[model samples]
Target: MKGSFSISVQNNTVKYAFSLKRNITIIQGDSATGKTTLVDLIREYEQNGTDSGISLSCEKKCRVLEGNDWNSHLSLLKNCIIFIDEGNRFVESKEFASEVKKSDNYFVIVTREGLENLPYSIEEIYGIHTSGKYSDLKQVYHEFYKIYGNFNLENKIQKLITEDSNSGFDFFNSVSQKKYICESAGCKSNIYKKLLESGSENVLAIVDGAAFGSQMNLVSELLEKRKNLSLFVPESFEWIILKSGVVKDVEKILEHPEDFADSTEFFSWEQFFTKLLTEKTKGTYLKYSKQKLNPNYLSDSIKNKILNLDLLAFLQNSVQ
Candidate 1:
């Protein structure tokens, strides 16, 4: 039986020592940090067999595919190791994330950054680094170019973050406001007709809460039109507030929406244009207004909310 192998950085030497147990391992770091290489090494070892029972069951390991085909892959890899490369790409699908969380077997997620607020226990997080060099930079550029067919460095970096499983931003930054756009009346009528034809009582519809009154008003309108219908407002609203300097007074606004009723609803294009001046002068003023009254008290509330609600997951799930 082959055992675990170690490679030396100085000599590019490989040595087999002991075997690793079947556990979930997350390889995370910045781009070109050898995360993919490390996962490939682990995969190779599994295929070749180590000194111990840690062996690759190729028949059991399944690669996730796009679209509805995941069901077939899930059935095949149930209770087995599933390798998810660039796991962040699937963040748009809450159902997919839910399924992965529900899986009983080990999953080795290879990501550029760690998956934050995931339910599964992270057995290990390995940070891989590369000695930056001219040749190394050239190799990275060449590989990316071959894959994407373009060499715009900034665009490539953005794409890398999106593709890499473990890579994502931790802190919140509001760059854009999320406003729900209602479908045209014709489209809405078609949707309702389709739902009725299918014998479904409820259909998911997106509506601009701003055009209505508040989110509550939008919900009430939907209730009047369709029975049993449920509406999900994306958490992007919170990000907008945070990014736009509204978080400092979220509690106050939530408590007294009538006070800032007009300003508290959906952000307008006018607001976006003026966000810079507002974020600098107006934002600082609003932020300090609450802080000046009870500094430590508000800070404590924010912390408590984060811990209790798993704010990271809330933010991610809300936006996506």
Candidate 2:
């Protein structure tokens, strides 16, 4: 019933595997590396009668919970298998982890990163990587289409990369930014809607700031609507900060003394942004596509950006 699925990339091939027991399974990987695909596959197998029912009677029984709603679903853990798309979203809550420990049911958590500190009894954890081969890329794309029903622009952009080897780097850069737009249009739209209705004048939008591209679009929308909004961006987002055209409105607000409280600490955005851009360009060729980049390098670059951002400090000061 409950299981975990992963596909390991080695020597240009992907080796897929799944668990056989009704135990907690954790699938960890970076963004766009198919963590969600594995979860959907397991959910489908369980629904189609191919997998043993670990928690629910039918495969159609899986549910998604956000915020406090996760607590209500914890009760069903004994008879239902819960698949969390972004497991890290819940890791900050001790009460949630406590409830998870008290539950006897199975859960399969899929996250961009692993959480070793959580209290749940995880039976197994697996890491998946993106495939390097064009054939594998096609297969993954097809699988993605099957699950999501239709291919979006991000899929089309990736497909373009697969078709033209010479355009890899350019396509990657363009698509990476476009992919952010795709996600912001869909995923972050919910958060935007929530903010619009919450009636809060001072709103804090916390995100994986260095995520770049579409993620920034989400922040842009939030900042445009909420005059008193503050963004908790990763340090790497300094690239956008330095890029004069990207966030002009926000920069203007920060510069004008009359626009914000005197307590607001405004700094030289252009200087910090330029420094990050220079450093990143010196380290890696801009022609490098994420698909072609070394996984360790990619992970480290992202993690360092997050760690150096002092995100909590920004959140504390921004959130009312």
Candidate 3:
């Protein structure tokens, strides 16, 4: 529920080894990539144990969730790692998201369709990769690889785009300071459209990486086609503020947020960061508000502190 879990599952034919840390992990790839095969192995191991010729190893219980009675099946699980194969239509529903928000379990979902209702991390999206056979040559080796790599800006940015309509947008818009255009896409789902419509030669789109999983595939495809586009995805604006050293005694928490962020309490790391920032800054000059950024955050010292952080330091020359 809070820590990472590594899983090793295999039969005589193939082996899969991977680790999942967040509440939601997405596995998606073209056909014949062993996406379904991995799930099948898990199901087989669960149904027949070692007798099924399949071996599954993990610290936590691993099982599959499916069928029309998924809500019931999910309700009984706790502190588990659940696997849901593709074709589980319930995974796309608001009902499933609601349940996931309340469940104390990690999910490894295989699907080509985006689950907008679920606030999963873009970093958690992965695809299967086959890398030859095992030592015995009896089992094929399979592993998970991140579908999207880190985004870095090699060229100067001429414009800024945000997925937020309020505080985040306000902060970046203020940073642009009329030198460059900064616009908000209004929401995460609209970021791609704004990018498609943005004809600028150099643009940087800022978004909440913690909840941007649903848009990664499509947006990444567009990124491949457009050389001038760049993405700057942090956990959230609140996370940026906390990481700025504006908050005291937060180094440990920032280093490993998973230790503090619980699955049931927070649907995504962004939500946890929002709550953490709001609570830590309450009744102080640095008080946080998502509806509108506190003007104090725009001050030279605070602004410089934020921009000085390594993750955002690149924006210093652009904003100036």
Candidate 4:
């Protein structure tokens, strides 16, 4: 269940080949992008098998979950890759998020709207596009592409905006050292509003990419019109700590997060990393807490180690 799964589903007119590495994968894009068609193929195959004029090949079962009875349907499934097309109000509900956290199955949801209740990764958000590889040019080929890319931090930052007021903000606020203004957006949803009101020429938003999928589209659209803003999205603050080599025996986990991140136990990678940090630093001077960061972590030796990471190298230039 921790391993990745690749799926190949096709009919005479179209084909989709993609891999799902995490528990939650979101498929969204413009119209006629084969998002719905991908779900239809799975539903069709589920109801009629090979005779449905479709072929599906995957190690795990692929099925569509919808309707008001989705809760009941989900209860009976395990170790599956469930697909949910848009218009299902259940997807946006807390009940669905609750079930998803408890279920061992993976999910591939198609929606343009973000689900704030679900802590899906920004890296998992994808858009479908035709790969343009087809036989006789009649059969279309669709593939999944990442909707968002890593932030470019080449520009100097005049202000820093973090998604939360907790440990993450504390760390960044300490590091800023009045070199630039560091403020919290309170939550991911408020990041857009913070950007709207900011008067800085260059702004950097540091958010937990692990659970920021819901606010990405809005922030992305805002970025297009506002060249002054850029994003510094790590999976989470805990991920930054783990990636900093501050924690021992985390190199493997950091390298292959998918292998250790259990879907049912932790809703997002952020939770997984948080638990890892708390456990690894238990009873140590660097003991971890989401509510308040340990003062020891802010010491020069430890602080420099974290800032030295490639992801946070921009802080050095900004502070200078």
Candidate 5:
């Protein structure tokens, strides 16, 4: 039910590469940026045409969906990688974004319009920048982070008032708050017990994509009782956005003299930014935390799909 596709295009003047995600991922840019050309190269490769500029590798067959055929195609499709050109008109509507996330397939969508439901910013799109690799599975761990795993469920769940099912969650709740899985911890009687006790409201459980490799079966057992109990994105969208958005600002701010001259205690860029993030957001910061608690399940080549997944936009749009 899972696979990967990677294509790199290189010519005398340009070189670009990006991979697709398990759910929806977008690529939007001005014309002649090689958006359609990239698709054409994939098609040519599919047709067995020789294009020295395009190199592709895949675990399974890849198909590009046409606008007229999307709905019917999805109905018939089950597990596969699909490329939907925006010209096929799939990314233009809120409805299409809704339906696509609920499917069990991977997608690479090209369009200029932003789908608020998807976790892509204009900067993170495929063709936006020509140089970087799409998925980097480097493990980011910190000595300060105490490992958390199989422990007292009862103790983790008892600490607070029940949260309403319809209560919405954004990046803020994750920063410095504990919603209490159990104050004393819930017994392993059922993972969903706290969720059920809390009520039918939208309780979002977000984990790292790497967890899929190590403990997905355990996670799945919990889900069998209730599908809405948890969530897992490639990493955190907070990390993704920081890397994509604020880092630029940090670099720009660095251009002027004495931004950090006053602070002798902050030596590393990571330390400076961690301090800055805490200051800016009132300690609603993401730093020094490890990427995931579990071991990886996928090979180095295909893991990027999970690493780069935008679970934030996907869940916000998919959950009711």
Candidate 6:
């Protein structure tokens, strides 16, 4: 955990050789970069205890923490070389950063994005590269900052004003007007029933994509049977604004800064919303959304999906 070590592989397409001199090392690159493959080979070498080229200077056993299963190996995390691969969803988490900072273990994290609030120094990050001999492939200061870019970390402090839903009778006071909410979920009759409480009518109906597509039968039934009701998703509404040019850039409309701590150009929605709550809101600031999924994070193929959404017209019509 305190010294340098190297992984020297033979007859493999992964990292031919990589060395770590710090307590925390970050290996970041795009997908299919042979990141996980290297971790597997290292783990296999350690488990087999063969004369493989992996060299360890620490007393603790070497382990590869794969996926979300990294948490299961927590007990063995101390004073060892902890190699955590991407896709675990913990790479961008603050909790993981806090936990990692509290220990003396050495970490080799394979991720496409950088972690926030980590203890690692700037010299710790390296852009992993494949397709070279062990002599030519050893990683150096990759300056991931150039590849990913920088972001805004402006934290806003405000008074903690608390309010309760029961404290306001606004929704209840206007109850006789027949308030309605629409969501996307189809084919789940029980869900529809639950949403449509006795006096409330369709209290929880949804068009949730996660549920399934629209059921014409149920949609028509609800439409005919229920009056003074409406369903809308804020995201769909957002699409409307975008299609109409009411707000051209999603980042500007959402008021989420087109910045991220790591992928500077990728327009991080998480940091943006976090800014709104901690910076721009009144009352109790409720931060929403997570992950670094925005326009900048999309691949060219799937990037079109974000632009060619058919819901634009529907969103526009619903709003108007």
Highest lDDT among the candidates is held by which one?
4
Candidate 4 root-mean-square deviation in Å:
4.1
Residue 101 local lDDT, model 5: 47
Question: Per-residue alpha-carbon lDDT of model 2 for 21-94, expressed as tens digits?
Answer: 32344555467677665455445544554343222233324544445576765665454556777754775466
- Over 4 Å off in model 2, which ranges? 1-17, 20-23, 40-68, 114-123, 129-320
lDDT of 4 by residue, 1-320 (tens): 57688898999988888888788888877787788888999999999999999999999999899998999999999999999999998999998999998889999999989898998887788777576632111111111012122334565568999997999999999999898889999998899999888774788788888888888778878877776777767888999899898899999888988889889888888899999999999999999999998999999999999999886788988887
The Cα local distance difference test for each model comes to: 0.33, 0.37, 0.83, 0.84, 0.41, 0.41
Q: Give the lowest summed-lDDT range of ten residues in model 4.
A: 135-144
lDDT of 1 by residue, 265-285 (tens): 212222222332234335343
Order of models, best lDDT first: 4, 3, 5, 6, 2, 1
Q: What is the C-alpha RMSD of each candidate to the true structure, in Å?
A: 19.6, 19.9, 4.1, 4.1, 18.8, 16.9
Candidate 3: misplaced stretches above 4 Å? 134-155
- Local error of candidate 4 at residue 72 (angstroms): 1.4
TM-score, one value per model: 0.28, 0.29, 0.91, 0.91, 0.38, 0.38
Put down candidate 6 lDDT per residue, 57-174, tens digits, no spaces.
3344567776565555765566677788777787567767666655656677876554544534344555656556443133433222121111111211111110112211121112
- Between 1 and 3, whose TM-score is larger? 3
Could you tell me the TM-score of candidate 1?
A: 0.28
Displacement of the residue 238 alpha carbon in candidate 5, Å: 11
lDDT score, candidate 6:
0.41
